[model samples]
Target: MSSESTVLIFGGCGFVGFHLVRHFVKTSTFTSVAVVSRSAANHDNHVDGATYHSGDLTDHDSIEQLLLKIKPTIIIHAASPSPVTGTPNEYEHVTIQGTKNLLKIAKRSKDVRALIYISSSALAKGPEHVNLDENHPLANTDPKSSAYARTKALADLMVLEANNPFPFSEPSVKETSWEGHLLTASLRFPIVYGTHDPTTIPGCLSALQKGQIAFQLGSGKNLWDFCSIENVCAAHSLLVQALLNPKRSPGAAKVDGEAFNIHDGSPHLFWEFARTVWKFAGHRPKNDKVTSLPAWFVLALASFLEWGYWIVTLRTKRPYNLGRQQVEYACFTHTYSIAKAKERLEFTPKQDFEGGLKEAVTWSLKQDHWDEKLKHVTLTN
Candidate 1:
């Protein structure tokens, strides 16, 4: 609300976190920004006016010290274990326990006014459905859900349940003098892709380069949802603004202890979108070069791979690139409705599919692994 309000972003050096930090520093009215990261190595990427604090989320004392020193008015929790890592223990430690620690510290802080959590749509249970919304049940009890999903669902519950208003019946030991409540909300993001993305874009490009993406798993017509990095950052900005100015926000009642799904508001056939990226990246999906496979066949293969990897890595933890969940994502339609976000947070995608794809391709081209020979490659269609 006030220009003097300080915002603290956890995982500030990460892909989404860095963009969020930049968004607040350069675009939003918030003048004071501090980023808490596991390492300050990316401090150079932070904007001129932003401050960086190095701290580990897993360490209670470390996070507490940082919170006490910064005394931030707003806190954005974006740090979590990488989805690609597929380490269950790591997800539990960083996502569940780390959030618990932050909540404990935040509850004690008199200055903290709002807390925004960055979550995932993987918490959706059952088969992929169209227009899934906030009322959809979380997949915490789903046996088939990924380790990341289960852990995140738990963390999401904890965050929403921790939202306590002022004049609380039970107050924290350090917050006796505080007058206001700790406002909290969560944003569940779908496949987020954009420049500096460490997951989606790079993984797809690497598979394409290696010729591993030689086939479409299903009809290539399954609709999927994606949220651009810019949109993700924009949603965070809107959430922060709403928390700061509740009466002015149109959907103020929906701001507290709420979770909203964020996407580009456009759904596309899975492989069609992939083909667009491939074409833009100087590659053509030829009929001969790329084969089409039945979804059942791919699912069978994925199951075999999952079992084989489990046996092979019995004593160790290794990320399996192909699994049942990956196959389900590729074969099913899973588009979420962002009506709540649009109404409540005034969230909108700043870039369309084509624009975001072009930006991603342009960014990818500048990477060191980009082949010069592929520069002039053109689409056959």
Candidate 2:
């Protein structure tokens, strides 16, 4: 806890919260940044010393009046939803009632100190065959898990039981606080590419500019792990300065309610990261002659189109809004373990996952749907 620090950012105009409000507005250790966002052009109003506050994280009195008017000292929950307009009850209404209304407004923001949270390496574990970590094992009954991994494993156990100390006098807890409050952390990430990737490569380049690709499912040798949106915002600013300086990690109280796995600990495969985005997008496309399939026949055709969108939303009464976790994340395969964020958050992922997929395929081949049969399917896949 040094000089300037007043962070607050819940989904700060998204895409990794707009690269964490442009790295906390070019940090000098953020002196006030507020954000909240539900609209107001989705916030990121060019962050310098930030301040946006619109609303809607399950509207608990608009996040308790912006957490009692920006009483922040860091509280970044990067707001969820949008696995295509979410469901599974909108992932239990914004990732578990918007993280219990942002931990009931960070237990009444008593100068909030640290909260972080940003979860999703599909709720701590999954792509096994070895290489997990951060005490992996929260699959929460993985019957091909998703409703965003059981609401991110019930919102990482409500931020580790809201960092105990008799969480509201513990007998079946109920949100009490003070007595050293906000110092919760949980950054499970992965598949978090760069430069504003609104969920997985700009939604796979907006489903290849609305063509809505049909085939090409799995056997693109699964493998996952990826990071860099400035190395996951410099490993969340060195795990919030090793949780506000605990001698910079003398095993910070045996890893305070831990959950690590950020990524880039190398593993690429998905069609060799789609043939280095078709040779760094110098002209390949049409999913470069797409033709792979077999991860149990793409999870048995996405479990028969998730039972044909659950019997066409129970015979078209309503509710369809797509997502079904992209056919169980196109036949899963996450692969993490950044060795406890490179041994207690010293963290080090500089990007070069095939050089950031050739700079997100040379900026998606300079946009306008790079055609020519996608450059002859990128010169023949």
Candidate 3:
């Protein structure tokens, strides 16, 4: 990586991609930072130094035209249809086929040197598991898995499989192994949240504000891992650096062709996360005390709703909220090991968890001048 190196991010306007564009631009590492997204023309929060291009990943001509035009030295892909949308067709075409198209064109490009794909830990086996890692076989292929899981797992494997072979020996000395080689790697993230988070944090706060979160869904004991968006951004930057100088990286093998599981490392009780949002936002459940719903009962009812919805809609649309997956997630424990990331890329959460929560809440409050009402309140508890 040098001053002349150029980087392009797919879905650069997205929650993850735009932050990445901001990250690369702030570092000033790449002279040219370009963002390619389907909705580029409508995005207004454009970073000053970076350029935005309208492109579709699922279209070969779209991908071909962009790659030929940009000729990026480092390509970071953070694009995927959001899980909340639950649009299986978009998941199939954009995440699965779209990644296929990007790789086919990128691998043949003489100027491209590195490719990093953002993948999801949802592909990990669901329920009754702890510290799931890259070796977990991407066990999301279970019969109940959604189209999202299947597409992500398939695309995740494809990106890693495209890596160039590198000497796996540790380096007592540093070396440049990136020239003329289009190395690829993947980062699997779990439940990312932070300031400006359009999905998770805002959704929870909105539901809380509306007094929709009436009761606990499960035992409220399951430990869920969350990665701050800043930490995720930092991890991508470090992995990009590690891939550039892997031999010098304090690890046994080059980061090429490997996937890393990353999170904030401290898994909190599942309900505690939502409670923190309420706590910081100076709100509480409509009820004075939260009560638990029977996990098995909820799961069964969700199954019935999912089946009924699918039948009524002829499977064109999924449930807006209640589903088997949602119930199961509420009931089960989900955590992943970041040991590989720590060892290989020296990646650590840069944003402290407590502070990140406060920042997220404060930002949300500032949106409505809600902060002025509770300046004395803080996260002392």
Name the candidate that leads on TM-score.
Answer: 1
Model 3 ranges with Cα > 4 A deviation:
166-181, 246-252, 284-288, 368-381
lDDT of candidate 3 over 1-381, digit per residue (tens): 544678999988877787788988999877899999888889855788998999999889878888888978779988898776566788888888899988888877766777999998888755455888789966446755767777788898989988874344534212343333567999999888776677777766665655556588888889888898888888988887777653443345558889999899889888777778877887643445667899989988988998899889877777866777667777888888999998888887764777888888788788645455445533222
Query: Candidate 1: minimum summed lDDT over ten consecutive residues — where?
Result: 167-176
Q: Which TM-score value belongs to model 1? A: 0.89
Candidate lDDT (C-alpha), each: 0.79, 0.65, 0.78
TM-score, cand. 3: 0.89
TM-score of each: 0.89, 0.32, 0.89
In model 1, the runs with Cα more than 4 Å from the true position are 42-45, 167-180, 246-252, 285-290, 372-381
Sort by TM-score, top down from the best: 1, 3, 2
**Model 2 scores what on Cα lDDT?**
0.65
- Evaluate model 2: give its TM-score: 0.32
Top candidate (lDDT): 1
Sum up the clashes in candidate 1: 0
Poorest 10 consecutive residues of model 3 by lDDT? 170-179
Clashes of each: 0, 2, 0
Compose the digit string of candidate 2's lDDT tens values, residues 306-379. 66765877632212223445544555566866777788777887757766666665554554345433543424
Stretches of candidate 2 exceeding 4 Å from the true structure: 1-7, 10-14, 19-33, 36-69, 72-74, 77-114, 117-130, 136-179, 198-222, 226-256, 260-271, 274-276, 279-282, 285-334, 337-381
